[model samples]
Target chain A: MSEHLPQAVVALDVGGTAVKSLVVDRDGVLHRASTPTRASDGPEQSFAVVLQAVEAALAAVPPTHTAVGVGLAVPGTVDENRGVCVHSENLGWTDLPVRDLVAARTGLPVGFGHDVRAGGLAEWRLGAGRGAEDLAYLSVGTGIAAALVLGGRPVVAGGYVGEVGHGGTTDGDPCACGGRGCPETFASAAAIGRRYTRLTGTPVDGARGVLDRTLQGDRTAELVWAEAVDGLGVLVSDIVRVTGASRVVVGGGLVHAGDALLDPLREHVRRRLTVHRLPEIVPAVLGGTAGAWGSVLLGWRAAGRGDAATVERYAELHRARVTS
Target chain B: MSEHLPQAVVALDVGGTAVKSLVVDRDGVLHRASTPTRASDGPEQSFAVVLQAVEAALAAVPPTHTAVGVGLAVPGTVDENRGVCVHSENLGWTDLPVRDLVAARTGLPVGFGHDVRAGGLAEWRLGAGRGAEDLAYLSVGTGIAAALVLGGRPVVAGGYVGEVGHGGTTDGDPCACGGRGCPETFASAAAIGRRYTRLTGTPVDGARGVLDRTLQGDRTAELVWAEAVDGLGVLVSDIVRVTGASRVVVGGGLVHAGDALLDPLREHVRRRLTVHRLPEIVPAVLGGTAGAWGSVLLGWRAAGRGDAATVERYAELHRARVTS
Candidate 1:
């Protein structure tokens, strides 16, 4: 009788810019919160930022439900099984036992993993990659990364599996990852904004602004956009060849470019792969909430309520919230 | 008491150049044979060639042993699960049900797979990729291809998984596969031989001959050899970045170059991958026998005598043949 009505969980996606946290139950998210992540201020400050967001989300849980567990999604090389950050360039962390620390502090079970991998899991299980036995989700934000889902599960090769942004040796200039000729240097959403700004000395909103200008026939915007498309084509073509992923889900802020981005990118990949079975390149369906929703899965997993079947139930519940 | 004799299986690796076959029991290979493959003469001739090799191998089986099954390894998009060749450019075949047809003709059960994939399976199970959970086997002969083994098993992906030769968008002229900038145009052993002869108008044995001349300070040989290494470096770097394979097993004819090939190839791969985990690039231990041995595995599988444990038992038997 004292089993505490119904239980919910707190999920946090710790990105470089902000910590997006949510309180969710089997019925879907009831509340959400965001907090600044002082990532450059080091691991301690970032940890604090995460804790603040978690606490706030927990407090916002519906009065009928009690928060039971926590799901933490972070950046960098993570050992999901051990719930440890092997290395995170953004958080300045190494060998940090995030699950144990958060579990101890919150007195709740914890599930932890790489942020991109988490988002990919959500996409694979219930979004764009639902029916795919193998899928590659390419997230093209300020930086590019991929989450490989093979055999209906994410391929987490000790967090080294999907660093295609830094892995690709395609067209480009010097990159922040200490490599030259990286595809993302010329293709990422941020790259479009930066290159366009530098070349034209004209300020635009972001990749979105550049796309708008391109639609309006801005020469600099067209060049920047065209180069981005070509670089992505090389990256995706290489990815299809190497991984044999038949379905490719392109995500992140740049997906807003829609047909303007996908059409030319598809042309580039098709032109390059003459003898290969072409992969289905499509926009990611989950958008920005992927990581946060993926966090819900992690939270449910930590609470011993997650599996393929449970994922369906949550998908049903959350999908109702989304579409309705 | 009447079950007196051990059973052997006939295995055939049908390639564009030849059909190499062997007879093997639980202990190891006992006999081998090869016949020219009339591959360009069309599918029927190729099938006849394969049958001749199989018959020759079965006839060579030890007098005390009974032949039980057959294993066929072919190129192109093979549905190993269905034992059908979806397409083979070399054999000029499409949807050719090799296993079923051979089984009907020989009145025996049969197993089948892609030749390069079978070779990679052998390498992963008992050779260069012995203990690697994920490994990439790159075979460079007249052409180039890769067999990817992930999570201790080969990734079949409906046989579209590893076509890195024509997959890479790199520096090159036009390719035979109707694509521009394919890595194989420069990196394959045939490419090395063809380019050197085209440039110097001097007769050479092959890539091996070019290497010998390069060692003797032949300038044209040096240029050709350098380009091959550079092309391979780009391909391998992209492969490493995209697949996250921590070990690369290089096989086929060019591996004979030893340090001359590996050293410069390693330098190129390193120069390209600035931030990825450097893979252990090594030579394949099996040399040319990998496909035949892998066919032995398929034969055993068809005979209901294969599994992870059976793979171990066969490895033990074959290792004796290899070493002693």
Candidate 2:
């Protein structure tokens, strides 16, 4: 271990269930750690967990890897310009100066952003959307939303843009967002599982179980899955028409289903389009680590060291890590 | 015209039936003219008409005004970068090098763009959307489309963006774009008129007739209008959610109905929105002349003379002319 090595950064993706932390150097990831968020304990305890997670990541940094900055990707409505977490329905955070608090504890500059946006940034810069000037990253996890990247820059419209989840898709089921027929109500991972259970009076693990049941020729499961796919198609078609994004990278738990999800979706959207050019729908290559990698990129950007070549290097390293 | 005077520009708004041209100077519109497009005569004849319209506008420049550039706004799928009118179902233009031809004819630089985008630029820079970084210009004319301006720059995704008209809305009647349930099938001025006619076996002039019938207590007209308003509301609500646009400027023939169109439409969209901030919905002030004024602005921008102050000067002069 030598101090002469190029500086690295600490990255954290804070979720309600767990915090994924990483020490990312120019060569590759130097260390990784995952810790419980303990979000239900209260906002104070959750903040403490965030701080501890960062500390542990920093402690894992090799002597040869000097930490330059820290990046945190949290799930919620965040005001990135002000370094404040405006609100998080999941983590129960409100107006928390997480960036300032983290910076004070670590004595390093902190780049704070929304989790979905961070993941989108990573995908746009390093994964499926690489080289695309206009792209969208649609994450269909517990909830459905999108990260819009236009003109080679991620659109952060006061952190309020990319709420496609709540955009109405039908006039049937009411959404948790207090709207009927929202894309989230039909296509979200949580929604798919809930709908399947509600329709058949049986419990399921998640979207994966529903997808599996559909593949096994369960009529109820097939109907629920088809509904989810149709809803997603409508949402994607709207995004493509509105944004003219050439590429749409699908991520989150639903993407793991691979062609089972993409083939039908591509056909559905293609049929729906009339004047708009058909966008290339693809899977996110970064998997669960995308948010953490996005945090690393954000940290580098915050440190003013995020050149295109540097980003390429990190992306190549991450790809190699996943393959190996 | 004296060469020493401040340079002005020739602007034209080319539509299916007519072309509106203007000689715009520092003091505002120095001269205005209108002529038939003769678009039924085929693409070559229509192109000749465009040239004649430019010549007519250039000829109207006052002795103190020196014409420096020309700008043309045309309906259809325009490739602004390549200066080609990709396709225009209305004007019958396909892959026409409008910019190059106009430039060659006028022996001056030309600025060419989509008609809706030109109107949107005018609204964003000089009309209702002034001072807002994120806004949408929704034109509910023969067809419904939007021009999205984000972060003070119009989102021109290869001229394919803002095709909200073709995005499905209800899965009912087939749209002219070969899609069913598209916004254009339910919300466009043409759709409103056609739906009203089909519902009551009465041929009406246009959307105005439908609105008039609705005000006269016709249940059929009221239902048609209500459906159009609802479709438009869903479209606008989706736009607001996806783009976080702070203001939505409604233009085109439909806006002439004023509060008749705005009041209920606003309420419908407001009710649909859940978490997103409600954007102020207002009518476009520039009216039919917006496209010509926008062409003028584009010409100035192309001539490397466009700045905020220059735009403000032109806008002030235009406002004075309207007031007078």
Candidate 3:
């Protein structure tokens, strides 16, 4: 507990196919490692793999660093207050007491939360959404989802608040969620690739390939890309109107398309709004590391040092690290 | 300042056509009055009418009652923190310093807020949404709007959070707000009547007439009514997925149809949801007076007596009054 000791924490961001683990110091420096989640191994085996990843990160922490706690961000429905993974469709977990198990195994206090929500927190505090009190982080990746930060706190809502992907944006498109016309059915990165392939009866790498084909004036790719952008516009416009978010930070794989995605999407959303305060739509700067950084912040809060000053100091360090 | 004195507040609910004024005691017992807003008289004149209504409510307060504060709820965009009415298209007001003006005129502390938000607060605290930490009040009136109560507090995002009416639901239907395919263009009470009339080249009273005609097996009426219900279903389903509200209280004119509106809406939204929490949709119990009661609660908060116990006592009184 010496004041001179450099504070560090074990942070893990567990996704469906991969787990990212990091030893994050208070200076916002990251020592990183990763492991395949092996979700197909089933819940118990995947849980064991998660623990191994955490142990590896813990082992990497230098002896000079003081390890205070562990922070975990997992995908799917979560009850953060109760520290339970309520249900994760991809991970095959149901009502797992993840926090208690992690605490018991690591003998460290655990701060558990939803991955997207934690990512939103990181972006809100230190990335593109910084300085905005009301913001939304929309991740358009394998599947579309959003994380809402309102009044400076991430809205958990029993881990169900950010399912905008399930909202209807079309008339009859079939969705994997067993619903029709869902935004995710047409707007997600997976959807763009799948739709283009289905229309042309040709294999494509993913949304990236679809975008490249569209750039080369491929009719089917252009149509698919246009539909995805339109669906995204409808969804984001609805979100802005409902939440009064002053800004929306777009992230995930599709964002790599840069202005090709942003410029048209912004114009479409702008045209949809009539009386709402126009939100500044921008790109997320933290890229794929938002969840890990957010875990560090969560660990700091768990250790009782997550005041405004501490957060600002860490944010400055993060900025310096990224820029350098 | 006497501990033995009963505290009361003057509360006003201002709309485009009329203003409701009342003297509300700490127990939520209300002595009410009304005045025509005459907004066509222009902003200054309407503002004068508003002041006159406040004075009338203050005059109605019993001499033994201690009027410590005032609460005013008005339609359109408001900045509650700055106590300014940013704009009210119906009232023809912009950048009006409503709170300071009321405070100066009445020598009382003032709580100013958006009408829909205040109404939502009342419903969440004392009406159908009672006991739900996350709830939404959807008002399907002349023009549709909503009020969101999240985590037991009204979300006031500079008076813009609940503009779901302006969100698109169809491909192209002109809206007064300059947007196309807005929910209000299809689902609002006015829309039902106007669309029915436009389709049949016949005039109808309102949504009630449309419902009555449908019950009588009128084909055109059935078509219009069905469209309104479908539009409402889409909007509510989107809202449920985005906000994760456990319940939604349907209020305003359309709820008067009761089961006719609620039954089909419940079924439609249920069909649209997949892997998301299904919200309980119910009629708002406070009817049209929700806004007035909400203003009283705002006044209570402004007077520094808005603890949970105090709120509960007021809620009981409100329930008794409404039931009686």
All models, RMSD in angstroms? 2.6, 2.2, 1.7
Give the per-residue lDDT digits (tens) of candidate 2, residues A218-292: 999999999899888988888998888889999998999899999999988898788887999999989898899
Location of the lowest summed lDDT over 10 successive residues in candidate 2 chain B: B314-323
What local distance difference test score does each model get? 0.83, 0.87, 0.86
Residues B29-76 of candidate 1: C-alpha lDDT, one tens digit per residue: 788888899998988888888887877887898889988889889988
| Ranked candidates (lDDT, high to low) | 2, 3, 1
User: Of the candidates shown, which would achieve the greatest TM-score relative to the real structure?
Assistant: 3
TM-score of each: 0.93, 0.95, 0.97
Model 1 segments more than 4 A misplaced = A1-7, A55-63, A66-69, A104-109, A167-172, A302-304, A314-324, B1-4, B66-69, B103-109, B170-172, B307-310, B313-324
- Reference-based lDDT, residue B36, model 1: 90
**Which parts of model 3 are misplaced by more than 4 Å?**
A1-4, A321-324, B1-3, B321-324
For every candidate, give the share of true A-B contacts it also has.
Answer: 0.56, 0.57, 0.63
Instruction: Put the candidates in DockQ order, highest first.
Output: 3, 2, 1
Give a tens-digit lDDT track for model 2, residues B199-240. 789999889999999889999999999999988898888888
TM-score, first chain, each model:
0.93, 0.95, 0.95
